[model samples]
Structure formats: C-alpha cells, structure tokens
Target: MKKYQPFLLTILLLALFPALAKSEVPIQKGERLNLSRCVETALRNHPVVQGARDTIRIGESRIGQAQANYYPQVNWQTDYTRINRSRTGNSTYSDYNSSVVLSQTLYDFGKTKTSVNIEKLTTDSFRQDLHRAETEIVYGVKSAYFSLLQAEKNRDVAVETVAQFQHHLTQAKGFFEVGTKPKFDVTKAEVDLSNAVLNRIRAENDLRIARVGLVNALGIPSAPEFSLDDSPLFQKEKIDLADALERAYRNRPDLQSIGKKVEAADESIKLARKGYYPYVTGSAGYGYSGEDFPLRDGWNVGALLNVPLFSGFQTRYAVEEAKASLDVLRANEASLRQTIRLEVEQALSNLREAQERTEATRVAVRQAEENAELANGRYDAGVGNPIEVTDALVSLSNARTAYIAALTDCRIAQAGLEKSIGKRD
Candidate 1:
C-alpha cells in the first residue's frame, strides 16, 4: 500500500502539471478595463500573435541551418565483420574497422553566402509578419471597444425613454381621475409604457452581446463579468492623402514582408545559377583496422572538386522557377499597394461622413430634448394631447440613439484610418 501511494502521488502530480502550466490569471468580477489595456492583453494572449512569434523562431533556426556550411562537419563510424574461409578447412576470422572524418567546404562560388543571405531575408519577413499580427489585434480591440461603448449609450437612452413613458402614464392616470383626460388617454399611455419596457429589454440584450464581442476581441473569452470605462472622444484631425499613402507604403508590415520575400527570391535565382559551378571540399580521416590483437592505424587527407557537367536541366529549371516566383511576388506587391490606397481613401471618406453626421445628430438631440420638455409642460397645463407628448418623447429617444450611433461610427472610422495608415499605436 505504501509503495502504491507513491505511484499514485506521482500520477496525480503528473496530471496536475499540465493544468498548472496552462493556467491563466482569471479576470475578476466587475474588473474595469480601458482600450489600451484591452489592446495590450490581446497582444500578449492572442494565439495569432503567439503563432507569429513562433514563425519568426522557425525562420531564425533556418538561418542557422544555412550558415552551418561555414563550419566543419565531424563524424565517427565503426564496423565489424566475421569471415568464413570454407576452402581453408572452414576457418573463421573477425575484422574490425573504425574511422573519424572531418570534412569542410572550401569554396562554392558564393553559393553558401547567397543562401545565408536569402535565409536572413526570410527571417526579416517573418519578423514583419509578427508586426502585422499585432497591428491587426490592436485594430480589432479598438473596434470592439468603440462598439461596446455605443451599446452602453444606446441602452442608457432606452432606460431614459422607459422612465419618461412611466412618468407620462402616471400623469395620464391622474388627469383621468380628475375627469380632465379621457379613458382612451390612460389606455394609450399604458400601451406606450409596455413598448418602452420591451425596447429596454432588447437594448439590455444588445449590451450583453457587445460585452461578449469585447471579451472575444481581448482573446479572453473565459473572462468573468467585467466593466469597461467609456472613453469615446470625437476630435477632428487634418490628414493628407499623399502623406497617408506614403506612410502606409513605408510602414505596412505585410508589404514589407512581401518585399523581403521578393529580395529572397532574387537571391534564390543567384543560388540556383551557382549550381552550374564547381564546389571544392576538403576532408581528413584517421582510421584503425584489425583482424586480431592490436589494430593498424592510418590517416588520410584529400580535396575534391565536384563539377556539375549536366543534371538533366535541373539547374536551368530551378533558375526559371525562382524567376517565376519573383514575378508572382512582384505582382502581389503591386496589388497590395493598390489595395492599401483604396483602404486609406475609403477610411477617410467614412470618417468625414461620420463626423458630419455626428455634428448633425448632436444638434438634433438638443432640439428634441427641448421639444419634449415643451410638450410635457403643455400637457401638464392641459393644452396638449397625449399624442403630442408621445411623439415628442419618441423623437427625443430616436435623436439620442442617432447621436450615439454617429459618435460610435466616428470612433470606428478613426480606428480604420489608423490601421490603414499602418499606425500600430
């Protein structure tokens, strides 16, 4: 039993090891988060970012492999054999052989050097890919952050509308009790209150959905119930289209990655062309051999010139393939540049439209608020009907919602513009 206890403990510890290693700090209930924190969290925790980092490591390893030819290779080998001499009365004998060899490349007409350069370029491309991943995550976080803020604002407006309707219903009931309003007014007010409650319910559900979106964007879906601090500010900034385009071309990681690939492809062509040249290698070996007792020892040194007379056009085809790949990469680079231009233009246009709408809706909300107040006052003074009050309140609610939407759009548009211009911050 005691022996089994140790085995069981070992098994238990092994089982728990994986869980402990993979455990992440849980988000506390009601934790407050802002946009910058969300972006940082996503960058640190997202699988896409981690995968990109792994890709860079792989490229770095490949660079080492390409550089390995610069160093000597050492190897040791051993062999034993038993021989039967049937003609000599079936006599048997054993033979043993061992050797240590050191080989190094003397020259390859810049083949190894070009390969190393290509690998370095490839690693640079992987680094750019990592940057691109982080940029995308940042943009996603920003978009989700703004969306959640919008949902919160809309929900607030819904709650306010419900409160206004409840007040109106109470006023209608009071007027009816005094015989100043008809029963129809009381019934209408009840119906409007019910609709407002329903809208509030829907708004609350939408807010929950927005919370889920933000959690997903943060790459922390297991996060507990948390609160976001609203911080949407609309500020106008001047942007030049030409300058934006230039920045995108200079800073976009995907474009830079492709450019590195193009350079690697050119180096590939050079490496393939070197296949037609001769390679010089030097090797030295020490060996021991014996049939019995002490063995005889010997050492040898030699140089080899391996010239490629022909290879069924393999070298020719490799060069051709490298050129074709280069052409494809160039075409892709051109296409990406065009797409970047369109993205920047569209982002700018959307931002302008959203800003204009925000201004318009801001004014509309103020007017609606004033109109609603006047209508409610008129009803209290017994000069306005229930319909006027309802209409004014509905208009006010809609104006507030529109203003929220416009503000959210402006924020999202600004994020889009930043992404298009390759601004990671």
Candidate 2:
C-alpha cells in the first residue's frame, strides 16, 4: 500500500512558516479521541450506515404491503339519483343506495405467502449490509488513527534532530572562539543546524495534516483540535491462514447477504409458478336502497374461481426472469467467495511483511543511535570532523523514520486482517 500522504504532510506547511510551529492550533486537552470512540462516532454519523438502516425500514414496508393481500379489504359506497320524466305523465322520483362490501383472497396457491417470504429475506439481507458498512468504517478509522500516531512520532524525531544540531553548532562556536576549531567547522555546523530547522518545520506540517485525516475518518470533518494517546507499535499477532479463511467464509456479511438474495429469488420463482394454478376469491356485502331513507335492506355473498388459459406467455416470461435472477445471484455468490479468499491471503501477506520490516527497523534504530553517539563523542575528543557527525545524525534520522513507517504499516495490516475475518471490536 502507498504511504498515507495526507498524514505525512501534516507538518510541511509549518516549514514555510516557522512561527506557526509553536502555536499552531493547539489540541485541546479534553479532545483526545481513541480508536473505539472514533469507530462508534463514525457508525453513528456516516451516511453509508444510515442509508443501509433506511433500506431495512423500506424492506419492512414491502413486507407489510405483501401481507395486506391476506386480510379482508372493506369499502363503503353511496349513490343518489333524481329523475323528471315527460313521457308518462311527467313524474318526479328519487333513488338512494348505500352499501359496505368486503373482499378477501381465500386461496392463491401460496402466492401471497411466497411474496411475504421474499420480502422478509430481502429485509434480512439488508440487515447484513448494515453490518458490512459498519465494519468498513471501523477499518477506515483504524487506518487513519495509526497514521496519525506515526506522523506524531516522526515530528518528535525531527525535534530531537534539530536539538542535536543546535548543540553541535554551539560547541563549534565555542571552539572557534577559543581558536581550537577552524572556520570551516563552524560554517558546516551552521549549515547542518539550518537543515535540521527545515526538517522540523516539515514534520510539524505533517502533524497538522494527519489530525485533519483522523477527523475525517471519524466522520466529523469539522471537529475541533484533538490528540491521541500513545499506543504499542510492535505488538506481534499470530494468525493462521487456514483459520482466517474459515472465519471469513462464515462471518463475512456481504457473502451472507448474497446468499439471502439467492433464497429470495427462489421464492420469486415459486410465486411466478402460482400463475399456472387457479385462484379463489370471496366477497360479501350489505346494503339499503329505496326512494327514501330506511325503506329496504338486502345482503349477499359469493365466491369466484379464475384459471389462467394464456396471456401472451407472461407467466412463462416471469418464471424465466426469476430463474435468470437466481442464476445471477449464484454467480455473484461464487465471485464473492473468491474475493474473500483473496482478501484473506493479501492481508496475511501484508501482516507478515510489516512484522519483518518492523523488526529490521527496530535493530537499525538502535545501531544508528549508537553510531551517532560515538561520532559526537569523537568530535568532542578533538579527532573527529563535522562530516562524520552530520552523516551519523542523518543515519539516525532515517532509521527512526523507517521504524515509524513500519510500525504504522503493522497496525494497519492487523486491522485489515480483522476486517477480512469480519471481527467486530
């Protein structure tokens, strides 16, 4: 993976404006955020998770509409008429009608039942989608958090380097005043100190940019200034590929969602086939009709059966469509499994590589620190040159940077593995 450029640029702007390094948007003491808090905030506020939840409610409404077919439908109606006739002695008369009618589907060969089942399955699928969205946001927060930590560490390294160079410049000036060191040594020390100041400015810029990225990941792009606590950078985690693969297969919400869709498609196919059978409907009504109010009353009930003969093969086409949808879902399920397997493998590879890099950089940091100390000691003893000290400091800085990068990579890789296995928390 490419290094997190946004986080790394946190302090670059500070290089251009050195005064801002000291008072640059100080982080509030009470604004410190941790990984779990960030994840929770994102889940509560992110639009993706909110949309997924809304889909669940939509699915529930569809289920209610499907079930309405099983209940009796009632309607109340009224009509009035007045007529004046010229052909039979010109008589005026009035007629009134009022009625309440109820209709219900007695049987449809389980068509309504199948539709309800499909809706329920679809709702369950969307519930799984919600889970997937939460998981993705958690991983994103973890990545940003780790990158912020890395950038902070790098800033500290830059500060220490500047201090070291300042100390060297002071010593050279002292020696030059006493006529022990040449003018070249003092000039070299001055040059090194200037470079260290430049680096420190860049590191400060990186810290600011990193904070912005963390805020974005938390789903609060306009959040106030904040900081993070120190976290262990080299904690090794042991994982078995076989076990991870099994967990991914069982727990991945996206895969389970696709399976639910396939089941719903099967139900759709059954619903379409119901068109081949006859449907029974029954209706009942009560009414009063007369020239005046309360004149007469009547009641009636009836049942009807309708069978399909042919209608341009619409039923056949519906069944075919359902079958095709099922086939597509199955294909998607297969593709998802392959994708899950690849994710697990890639995460494992990244974790192992990061672990190795962390170890290598850890050793390098120790050696470089020792070398810098030795070089500085030699220069103090009046035998070493400025070049030796400058080279040693550069090596030490590079080692620290590499170690920080490696540690951040390790944390991100672990998060990736957890995501692949659908591990919450």
Candidate 3:
C-alpha cells in the first residue's frame, strides 16, 4: 500500500478535475476525440461556422424581399385637418380622413423574375460558403490532432532515451568501482540523461500547445487531461483514382463556391439589365371623399407605367459595373479550377509517396528492433562496446520516429485529398 501512494495521489487529483457546466455536453477533461468527432464538434460549436450560419439566414431573408414583387403592397393612412370655419362652409366640424391604399404589379418586363433569380443565386453561393467553412474546420482539427499524437510519441522517445542513459551511467559506475573503466563515460552518460530530461519537458509542452489548438478548434476550454481515442481515423477504404479526380472536379466546396459566385454575378448582370426596360404596373385604391354627394364612400382602380428616359446614366453605369463584375468572377473562376486541379495533383502525389514510405518504414522498424536486441544481448555478454549499444538505440529511435512520421504524412495527405475532393464527413 505504501508503494501505491503516488498512483493513488494521481487518481485523486484526476477525480478533482473540474467539470464543464453543460451536462448534455461532456466535461471536456479526459475526453477522447478523433477526426470525425472533432470535426462534428467544431461544426456544431465553432464561432466562425456559427457566423456563417447567420449569413445564410440573412440570404434567406433577403430572398423574401426580392420576391415581394409577386405580392401586393398595402399602405394605411389617417389624417385630420382644421380649417377656418368660413373657408369650406363647415363650422366646428372635424375634417377627418382615413384610407387604405393597395397597389400591385400585374406585370413587369422580367425585372421581378431576374431579381428573384439573383437573390436565389446569392443564397446558393452562401450554401457553398458554409461548405467551405466546414472543410476548413476539418483540416484544422486534423492538423492539431496529428501534432498532438506526434508530441506524445516524442515524449515517449525522450523518456526511453533517458532510461537508456541512466542504465549506461549505472554500468559505468560499476565498472569504475571494479577498476575496469574511467570516470569519463559515467560523466557523459549523466550529461545525456539530463539532456533527455530536457527533451521530455519540451515534448510535453508541445503536447500542451497542440491540445490548446485542438480545444480552440472545438471551441472548448484548454487544459483538459484528455485521453486520445483515434480508432476511427485509421479506418480506410481504397479510392479509385479516376473516381477521386471526378469527385474533386465536381464537389470541391471552394471551387463549387466560386462557381456559385460566378453564377450569382451573372444573375446580377441580368438584374441590372432589367432596369433598361420599362416597368409596367397595375394599381387600385378605394376611399371616401364626400363634399355632399350621398355622403359617398367608394372604390377606384387604375394602371400606370414607368419608363426611365434618363437619370445621369446611373442605370447605364450599373449595367457596365455588373458586366465588369461578371467578367472578373469568370476570370477568377477559371483560375480557381486550375488551382483545384493543382491541389488534387499535389495531394495524390504526396499520398503515394507517404504510402511507399510507410511500407519502407515498417521494414526499417522491424530491422532496427532486431539490431537493438542483438546489441543488448552482446552488451550483456561483455562483447559489445557502449558506443555500439548507443548506436543501435539511436537507430531504433530513428526507425520509430520515421514510421510515425510516415503514418502522419499519409494521414495529412489523405486529409488534403479529402478537402480537395470535398468529401463531406
């Protein structure tokens, strides 16, 4: 029981960790997060995504205003006038008038249709913008997740290196007592052990920073004692190259977003051109205006047409502005398509390289393990020098680091591919 004191203390401290206020949401400390869950959490919680959602609602509301032409416009008014008693032949009489007026456009020369089209197109552009935000969140979360994993592995390596040097120091001290070696080896080992301890601290700090990034991505607080659960991130299925390319061309959100923007700009040009045509509208109003004719309250109906002969050429300038915008968006869209292809190409290339490296690194890790074991056996048998053992350990460390790096590179490449191709979830 005495030997378990530290373990018990650690458990007690963990139990004392503060929990979050939201019960439906997990207390963040000790939470296990993977790419999918992290992305989902971010999409649901990130402030940027929420702001984008608000913009979508704004677009939706504006669509109603653009479509309001299809419905009648109603106006209400009430007024009272007091006149000199002799002016209108009525004395001390309240001259009050109240009326409701309604007007509607029975027809317009494509202005209403084009305006509605532009608003709908604008809404579609925002839909793509939301997709872009979601994709960005996924990529950011993944990068932070991988960084944390690497930091953990680095920490483990540092600890193992420290233990190796401590063992070396112990062996040197024993050999020196037996009068078989000098004090220099022991001093060198102590120095290496101290450096390894420093390395371990740095790695731990790196992990903390990475955790902070992940917390930010998830819109949660940092400083959680979270355990990792990445069982899902490694789930893989082969993607047909042609299908991937097709999907990239079709579904890449940023590109689709640009495409929608170009369409919206085109719609704007049409909307602007609509002002060049005459606007024909039908209108009707009914009220009471009785001087003395049967104390009459009655109905009236009429129609009107509006044509803009000139207005400082504002409408003409607007058309030119819309056309210029259309031209610019078209050029930008062409550039975007090329950019998408380049990304797809680069991600494909990196993934292939990482895949090959993974296989190579797997073989290297195995060979290094064998070498380290042989070195250890030889050292115990007094047939190996300290330098040989250190070299073998170093080789093992390099192999392990390389293997982890290969896997990390593969995962990062996969993420880039996913983003390039717009693979949702």
Candidate 4:
C-alpha cells in the first residue's frame, strides 16, 4: 500500500509539472534567422524604428489639429446678475441670460490653407524619417549577420588548426620514440600544439560575442540559440559611380525628409506673411433672457473685421525668421548633397578595395594550404624538421584568417553601400 501511494504521488507531480520533465537542450531546436527575417525582426522590435513610426502618428495628429481651424466653433453660456441703476428704493432687480453662440472664420488671407499644407508636408517628412530608420536597421542586421558568420568560420578554422597541430604532435612523438626525430622536435611540436589550443579557445569566445552582437542587432534580448544561414561568398559587383550617386540623390530618405521640411518652411513663410492682411469673421447667437422662464427671446447675427495696424514689429520679425529658416534649409540641402557624394565615393572605394582583398586572399589561401600539406608530408616522411611544419601550419592559419576577414569586410561593405544608396526595406 505504501509503495502504491508513493507512485501515485509521483504521477500527480508529473501531471502538475509536465514542463519540468522537458529536456533543456533538445537537439538545438531554434529559429533559423536568415537575413531578410533578421531585418524584419529588427524593424518590428527596434526602439528607433518604433519611435520613428510614432513620429508619423504625431505628425498626423498635427495635421488634424491644423485642419480643425477650417471648421466653425460653438459654445453655450448663461449669466445671472442683480443691478441697482440709481440706489433708490426698489431699484435692484435680477437679470438672467442664456445664449448659444457660433463663430466661423470667413476669410484669413490663406493662413489656414498654408497651415494645413505645412502640417501635411510635416507628416510626409516624418514618413520619410520612418523609411530612413527602416533602411538603417536593415543594414545594421546585415552587417551583424555577416560578422557572426565570419566568427563562425574563424572558429571552424581554429578547430581545424588545433586538430592539425595535435596530429603533428603525435607524429613527432612517434618519430622521437623510433629514434628518427630528436627530443627538440617533440618539444617544439608540443609548444605549437599548446598555441593552437589557446587560439581555439579565443576563437570560440569571439564566436559567442559575435552571437550576442547579432542578437542585439535583431533587437531580441531573449532570442534562442539559433544558427544563421551562410551568405554566399563575395563576387565582384560592378557598380557605376555616376549611377550610384544618382540613385542616392533620388532614393535617400533623409534627403527626401529634408526636402519636405524645406517645402513646409516655404509654406510657413507664406503663413507668416499673411499677418499683414485683414481678417474677417462671422458670428451668430440665439438666446432667451428674462427674470423668469419664457419671458423674452431673440436672435442676433453679425460680422467683424480686424486689421493688423500695429503689433510691435511681431510680423516683421516672424517674416524674417521664416526667411532665415528657409535659407537654413536650403543650405542644409546643399550640404546634404555634398555629403551624399562623399558617401557614394567612400562606399565605392571600400567595395573595390574589399573585392580586391578577397580575391588576393582567396589565392593566398590555396597556396598556403598546398604549402602546409607539402611541409606535413615531408616531415612525416622523415625528410623535414618540426620547425618547417610549425611555420607552415602558422602560415596556413594566418591565410585562412585573412580570407575570412576579407569575406566579412566585403559583405559589410556591400551592406554599407546599400544603406548609403537608401535601399528600402
């Protein structure tokens, strides 16, 4: 009976805590985030992207507020008062009034229209800003993805190097035991093997850090341990400088945002200049006023005109400020044009340099591998020294490292070029 009770308790516990029985690391089940998916995740989760999207909403709200000026305003009011006209006997009486008033702007010399246009342009500018943010996140994710891939490749190379050194160490010891190699050969091989182990450890640490960077880029703090799909190796892409510059000029969202701002500023200038003209408004009211209910009733309607004769130079200063603001935007547009040109030149140069480096290192990797293989064969055949093998191994390791670096650089530079040209999400 006691054994059955214990078994029943265990069953209850398992039923209550089923998740506790699951494996912690079961076959690496995690999402495989490709480049496009990574970019999508970043755009969805990144704070900057979210904030930019919120800015568009804010701009929309502003546009609504500006359009509100085009509509009529209405209000209700009631008042009660006691008055003595001459301080005589029975001279005080109660007066009651209630009214519903309506007011509408009949004309304002296009001020309301200009304001609405400015708000609309502002919203467009914010939209462009959002686009720019999305573009930036896309590039950021690509760069980080490439870096992680490079780290993984480097780690693999380190593992291979370690294994090769271990093989060389075993061979050296065997030769020493057979009296074919000296003790010095075995000692040198041991040192090289130890160095390779250290390098492997460093490479592994780098891979972990790279993974963290990729997660940060994805903006997923709690992302699972996932593998990335390897991007294709770099191929030389021929991009014309003139065409790239043109694309940047046409496609850059930041530039477009500034252009919208300039247009808004032009509207602001017109809005400010409207202060010089007269404003005319129409109003109407319907009311009942008496000491008691249903005593008297009447309605009134009228129009009012206001001229800005003197405002302490406010209009003058506002016009000056608007003109100055427009000038500033124009200057910024010019500066941005220069900046775009420089970015295009720099990206083109970097892409060209990376392409050249990758090609050179690709050949170097093949040659170094051959050299290392030859050295290993000679030593194994008792025709070479341990020093030759160690040197060749180191050369091969360095060559592989350079090749990986070049590949990463090329990929990162390509992403940079895409960003500089304002590739849309």
TM-score of 3: 0.84
| lDDT (Cα atoms) of all candidates against the true structure | 0.91, 0.89, 0.77, 0.89
- Residue 259, candidate 1: C-alpha displacement in angstroms: 0.7
Total clashing pairs for each candidate: 0, 10, 0, 0
lDDT of the structure predicted as candidate 1: 0.91
lDDT string, candidate 1, 1-425, tens digits: 88799899978987979666445564556878877778888888888999999999999999999999999999997899999999999999999999999999999999989999999999999999999988898899888988888888899999999999999999999999999999988999999999999999999999999989888888889888877877544555668789889999999999999999999999999999999999999999999989986999999999999999999999999999999999999999999999999999999999999999999999999999999999999999998999999999999999999999998899888889888888886
Q: Top model by lDDT, which number?
A: 1
330 Cα displacement, candidate 4 (Å): 0.4
- The true-structure Cα RMSD of candidate 4 reads 5.8
Task: Report residue 326 deviation for candidate 4 (angstroms).
Answer: 0.3
Model 4 residue 100 distance off true place after TM-score fit, in angstroms: 2.1
| Model 4 residue pairs with clashes | none
* Worst 10 contiguous positions by lDDT, candidate 3: 18-27
lDDT of 4 at 393: 92
lDDT of 2 by residue, 1-425 (tens): 34877665766776777767645433334577767777777887777788989999999999999999999999997899997888979998999989999999999999999999999999999999998988898888888888889999999999999999999999899889998899999999999999999999999999988888877877777777677766545566889999999999999999989989999999999999988999999999999989987659898899999999997999999999999999999999999999999999999999999999999999999999999999999999888889999999999999999999999999999999999998756
List ranges where model 1 is wrong by over 4 Å: 1-28, 83-92
Give stretches of model 4 more than 4 Å off: 1-29, 80-94, 291-296
Q: After superposing candidate 3, which stretches have Cα over 4 Å from the reference?
A: 1-23, 26-28, 80-96, 232-241, 286-299
- Highest TM-score model number: 1
**Comparing candidate 1 with candidate 2, which one achieves the higher lDDT?**
1
Ranking by lDDT, best first? Answer: 1, 2, 4, 3
